[model samples]
Target: MERKWTFLTSHLTSLNASTRPLNGQTAIVTGASRGIGAAIAVGLARAGAHVVVNYRQNAEMAESVAAICRRHDVRVLTVQADVSNAADVSRLVETTSAHFGAPSILVNNAGVAHTGLLLDMTEEEWDSIMTANLKAPFLCTKAVLPHMIARQYGRIINLSSIWGLAGGSCEVAYSASKGGVIALTKALAKEMGLSGITVNAVAPGAIQTDMLGHLSDEDLAMLAEETPVGRLGTAEDVANAVQFLALPSSSFVTGQVLSPNGGYIT
Candidate 1:
């Protein structure tokens, strides 16, 4: 007999009270203007962490996410910076520190995806994808690590993908970049463990985000049917996982990749 899959909502009752688990902490979420990044920002705010919503080109959308976070009664700030650039990463970290002190949590959610056959991909395209999806994490983590190490406490969560674990056809660049993210998480976790910092990754599968806009109705329906849960994942599904990993109590967990894929790849 085939086993049935349970939706994430079915496990909601197992969660603890809505009380703040991250009070007085500050978190920085990169590329938080929309989609999964935006969801993670709001989720962190609701948990009582001051949030710095980082965006590269969409100021309006970044502010919109900030407004949602503000409604949670937690402090919210919006910053614009190209995470892949060293100077910009420095500016982002400095501004956050000036306003909210050094961040206790850094969510490297900023990333770009490209879907195409390797034969058709250009060098510029591959470079851009790698810089955004992989280099940004390295730069941001470097900028934040000093503060975290000094404080002896921090949470660094990288947004990875199912493709990182299992390669995707026609998405070679994207797969390789996310795979680098997973590798970075593991190495950094070990390096930072002695300093009381935990590093981890959240890999989402076929989420209902703007990223799926390119897919046709039939394509989406086919993907849903393929998933054992009979549905696609959600930004909130990934957000919930980030929230858990960000908690102070999760100190024992490190170098882990939590995939909210709805049984799509497991």
Candidate 2:
């Protein structure tokens, strides 16, 4: 017997609705100027959450994303801060708090990707990726935990990578940092459990974003063909995972790695 499946892209539904499940909540997304971060920001907005779009630079792009989110009628604010720095992170949280009360959801999606030999990588480069990918989540999570604990409810979804699950060649630093994210999610999930906060990680695999710009068409085709889904995943695909984690309905699913990798690594 042969079985086949069809995915209807055109049939996808919008995340926005006045009565959507996230109504009255607020979400903060880092690295949201473009790429997966942008998609997640809008998706959270569509679900009726007042959103904070956080970007280090690229104000123009961040504002553009904010404009789109505004169409959903949710309160949207664009904040510029380098998530890897502690002082900047504090200010970012404070600014969000001033405008939206307190963030109920935090998406730690700001990260850089590196590819090179471990020996060839400079110490600065290694530290840069680690700070952005791993430490920022630590700081962001720590900053938001107090309020979430006080309210006894929070959703923290960290953006990890499939490379974190299966190491990548020529991407040693990136892989190591994402793996640390997984560790952070697990440990924090345990720590925040009784406090009514859930910490989880979303590891997208070979998503079709600017991150794949370095790949040639042929290379991308090969990568897509290698996946069981026969295609590269979209930024929206990853956002779907984040959305699920952000929902109040997902309260029981904590300390988990939800990888939307098209079954490439599985």
Candidate 3:
């Protein structure tokens, strides 16, 4: 039998969404049209959060993700924005606020992945990777800080990469950006600790997502075998981590890199 995205499926239908952990809070999940981002959004919703599904493109897919969230009986909003663009991020947050008051949970999951040699990588490519992966986090974090600061409560979860810790051979730019994200997570956690906002990073190892579209079946199998768990991670696997970080129970867990890479790297 084939596996499916059970987190977003009727499996969650059995849970008591109203009494879930994040009830009544608002969460904004960027790049949530599909894959890990989508999973995180749905997971947050299932936890009873009013979710804003942020997507750069793919309006239809964003709506589909939103529709699933609604099944959990939580409020759902879909906003289209290029988070790397500060103006667009401004609108994204503003729209989320206009509808759901202020977002207490922010999952900075919007990122672009690149796998190529340093010699072959162009300046434009490097900039795009940095802009999307690094700058977007900076922009979104900056935009949401004021509201969170005033309320003295917030959860900021960044989606990093396993390569960010153990650099990938042909993935210089991507590794660099994700490394920056890890650094950002630690530093921001320190800065926000006094303000009741906890910042953390989730570095997922070889998840079975569209991000791995370039890899062949053999390559995926090899990666799975290499993983101690003997299988690749799932978007829900990472989403489960994000959900924990987003909860009030994780208030004391800050400035940490919660890598869900199945022990791919220690």
Q: How many collisions per candidate?
A: 0, 1, 0
Give the Å shift of residue 265 in candidate 2: 1.3
How high is the CA lDDT of each candidate model?
Answer: 0.95, 0.93, 0.94
TM-score of each: 0.93, 0.93, 0.93
After superposition, the stretches of candidate 1 with alpha carbons farther than 4 Å from their true spots are 1-18
For model 2, residues 1-266, the per-residue Cα lDDT tens digits are 12222233322322333248798899999999999999999999888899999999899999999999999999999999998889999999999999999889999999999988999999999999999899999999999999899999999999999999999999999999999999999999999889889999999999999888999999999999999999999999999999999998899999999999999988
Candidate 3, residues 130-178, lDDT tens digits: the string is: 9999999999999999999999999999999999989999999999999
Identify the leading candidate in terms of lDDT.
Answer: 1
Report the poorest 10 consecutive residues by lDDT, candidate 2: 1-10
lDDT of 3 at 4: 65
Cα TM-score of candidate 2:
0.93
